[model samples]
Target: MNANLKGAAMMVAAMAGFAVEDMLLKSAARDVPVGLILMIFGALGTVWFAALAKSRGDRLLNRDLLHPVVGAKSLAEIVGRLFFVLALALAPLSTVSALLQATPLVVVAGAALFFGERVGWRRWSAIAIGFAGVLIVLRPGVDLGWGSVAALLGMLGFALRDLATRGAPKSLSNMVLGVYGFLALVPAGAIMLAVTGGAGVPPAAALGLIATASVVGTGAYYALTSAMRLGEVAVVTPFRYTRLVFALILAALVFGERPDLLTLLGSAVIVGSGVYTLLRSRRETQTAAAQEI
Candidate 1:
């Protein structure tokens, strides 16, 4: 397959993996503290990725790890994962996942601002409409809560991480990046656990769930990093919308979550805006190419 196609496929797989990981983490949270789950989950993923790197004869301690972009990505990862896990634990799955759908919109806008990528008025309008959808999902005065706020912050953090990922050193392997990504979760979880002051021996079932989530999450992280590197960000990013579908289905089936009309409508709006942004980006790219030709 072509690079864009491969990237799109990898993105879809990553979204599916992430959906499953969220489900598992949410399930485990019922039995274990959210902070504890994050710590264990991050530690397991870190070990797995570190081992993968070692087996491949790749150095885990590359100087590129100290790159400013990598540091920024690491901090973003911590913020994203920390708050997202909290949202999953405290909020309805459907709501948290719906808010998460706004990530690409944030990333597109961030690209324009931070990387000096050109974003025309049309794409800018789409971004505005997309964030308006976020407000629809939030329904500010009606149902705004800490969970909703956490989900929004988490989405922003993840968006920033994606933007930083685009500038990460090419010398670093995906596995190596995965190691650092998961490693960041360690301190994130520890900080939360320390503040919340709850760490206990999780039940065996919770341990099993956390372990499975770590493995799935590790794979998802790999796929995500690979997808970002494989093709144009705009081409691969729309597939991220698929996560909402997966999350909605899983939420309904597993958690008995039936999202309200506003939530569904807001999700549709967000997805529509995101798709439009992608089409606009592709059209611009094609026009630029044809002009060059």
Candidate 2:
């Protein structure tokens, strides 16, 4: 199969796995502490990735993983995972997922600022409008609260994580990055657990849920990395939107959430703007390539 198609399929599967992971964690939140859930997920993911790396004869802990840029990436990951998990526990899953669609827009702005990438006025305008869409979803001054703010913070954290990933040394394999990403979660979970102590021996069911989420989340990470590496990024990246579809379905079926019209409109705007930004960036790359040719 062609690379784009392969990547698209991988992206879809990866998103499905992620959706399942979120659903499982959300369900377990009823009986398990969010911090404990994160702790278990992080520990299991670290072990999974570490073992996979070792099997390939890669170092379990590379000094390069602690490089400044990677350290920043780890910090972003901690923030992103911690807030996103908390948002899941406290907010509507579909709404939180929709808000996360703004990450690409945030990433675009972040790149221009931190990475010295030149973004044209048009893209900047789009980013502005995209954030406006986020505000619409948030409905500040009307339905505004900590949950909405937490979701936005989670989006920005994820945006920072992605932006930092751009500066990661190419010598480090995806497996190595994966291991470190999960490893950072160890400290993140501990900090959260310290603040929100609900620690106890989890029941068998909670343990099972945690194990299932860890395995599925680990697989999703691998699949996402594979998809990005294997296909044209523009093709694969758009498929990330499928996560919203999966999330909305799960929310409706599992949580009985029927998003209001404004929420749906806001989601549409976020997706449209993000896709436009990515496609425009891809066009710029192509134009630059042709000039080089």
Candidate 3:
């Protein structure tokens, strides 16, 4: 198969995995507090990544740990993840997912500012239009609350993390990166737990709920990785838009969220812009590749 076609397929699968992961967590969130959910999700992720490292014989302590900036990036990811859970708890699933479209814009700005990547006017314009679409969906009034704010910050923080990752030392293995990300959550979760008191007593049913959420999350990660391993990276990357479809269905089923006309219009704009971003990125990459040869 063409590598691009393979990558496209894998990316679609990865997007589905992420959507499933979100659905699972959101399902559990109705019954559990945000802090406990974060901890369970984090712990599950840590254990999964750790076991994979062991099975693959990935070294624990390499001299080339992440750069200081990279460490900061990992911390940003922790913050982003926490806010993501908070967002799910606070906003409509589709709305929250739509807000997440801001991440690519943030990443573009971060790349230009932090890495000194030359930002052409065209990409910047696309990003600006994309963010305008986000604002339309959010329509933040006085009642939007801290949850929305947290989700936005999370998106921006994740973008910063990606920028930091680009500068990361090549010596750091993916296993190390995964470990850093998961372990970073521990302290944050502890703090949140201290403040919130750990999701009350887990009812008999809560255990099953939390467990189910964690398992789905782990599976999502596995599916995502497998997709990348099997498919080409650039082509597969655009399939991530499927998360919105999944989130919308889950929101309606789980929380009875139904979108009015404005939401649909905004979503169309965001989706178009996101797909454009992917197409543009792939073009640039191919151009660079051709130049190198």
Compared with the true structure, all predictions reach lDDT values of 0.89, 0.87, 0.73
> TM-score of the candidate numbered 2?
0.95
Write the residue-wise lDDT of candidate 2 on 1-293 in tens digits.
99889999999999999999988888887788878877888889889988878877887666787689998988898888888888888889988999999999999999999989989887888888888889889999998778778888888899998888889988777677778887888878878888989888888897998899999988898899889988998889989989989999999999999999888899989888888899889988888899999
Which structure among the candidates has the greatest TM-score? 2
Residues 1-293, candidate 3, lDDT per residue (tens digit)? 77666666666666666766776666767788778777766777777777777777887677666358668867887888889888887767777787786677677677788778766677778777888787777667834667667778777777777777777787765656777787777778778988987546656576676666666665666666666676655566567677787778877887799987777677767777777776776677788889999
- TM-score for each prediction? 0.91, 0.95, 0.89
Once fitted onto the true fold, the runs of candidate 2 whose alpha carbons sit more than 4 angstroms away are none
Question: Among these predicted structures, which one has the highest lDDT?
Answer: 1
lDDT of 1 by residue, 213-274 (tens): 98887788779878988978878978888999999999999999999999999999999998
RMSD of each: 2.4, 1.4, 2.3
Model 3 stretches with alpha carbons more than 4 Å out: 1-5, 198-200
Better of 2 and 3 by lDDT: 2
